[model samples]
Target: ASARKKKGDSASSTTPPTPTPPTTVVAAPRLSAAAKGDKTDESDKGSDDDNDDNNDETVKAGSESDKDDDD
Candidate 1:
């Protein structure tokens, strides 16, 4: 009976505390025109880079076709 009581006490002492649910974290919402403009500006920069790469490929292809025509 003493051993059983000791074992029960140890089990209860070793048990972990109940975990609390994490605080709800929300992203800062964008609601201003300037903030919207900033996003548009960033997107435009990406598209411009893509356009430049595509233009370079098209020019290379055009030059290669011209060389073929010459031959």
Candidate 2:
């Protein structure tokens, strides 16, 4: 009962946070423009961006410590 009270208090007292949706839209305007015409690589660019970001973060961490930070 005491544990539950503590858990409830912790949960309720937490401020509402803005959650970033998992959907990754890479440049909506450019994507729509590409769909109209001009062969534009969307997946490649998005993947590359993700890879770059991951690499940059990994480099900053200086090792495999990123996995731990996520937890």
Candidate 3:
């Protein structure tokens, strides 16, 4: 009995250990600019209007400067 147990133990110890499965890191899908709430129609229109207003103000200032230069 003792010799049989020793042989079994030696057989198990000689065998290589099973390899673990590789860790798969799956990333989440990337959100589009519209999905992220940046390029939506409402937001884009609002921003475009704000940009147009800012550009008008800048043009007015530029025209004033031009008038000053002309004077």
Cα RMSD, each candidate: 8.3, 18.4, 12.0
Q: Evaluate model 3: give its lDDT.
A: 0.71
Q: Model 1 over residues 1-71: C-alpha lDDT tens digits? A: 99999999887766533222221112223345667789789888979998999999999999999999999
| Residues 1-71, model 3: lDDT tens digits | 99999999887776533222222211222345435666576777889899999999999999999999999
Pairs of residues clashing in candidate 2: none
Q: List pairs with backbone clashes in candidate 3.
A: none
Instruction: For model 1, give the RMSD to the true fold.
Output: 8.3
Model 2 accuracy (lDDT, Cα)? 0.67
Q: Return the number of clashes found in candidate 2.
A: 0
TM-score (C-alpha, index-matched) for candidate 2: 0.29
Clashes of each: 0, 0, 0
Q: Which stretches of model 3 miss by more than 4 angstroms?
A: 1-41
Best by lDDT: 1
How would you order the candidates by TM-score, starting with the best? 1, 3, 2
Worst 10 residues of 3 by lDDT: 19-28
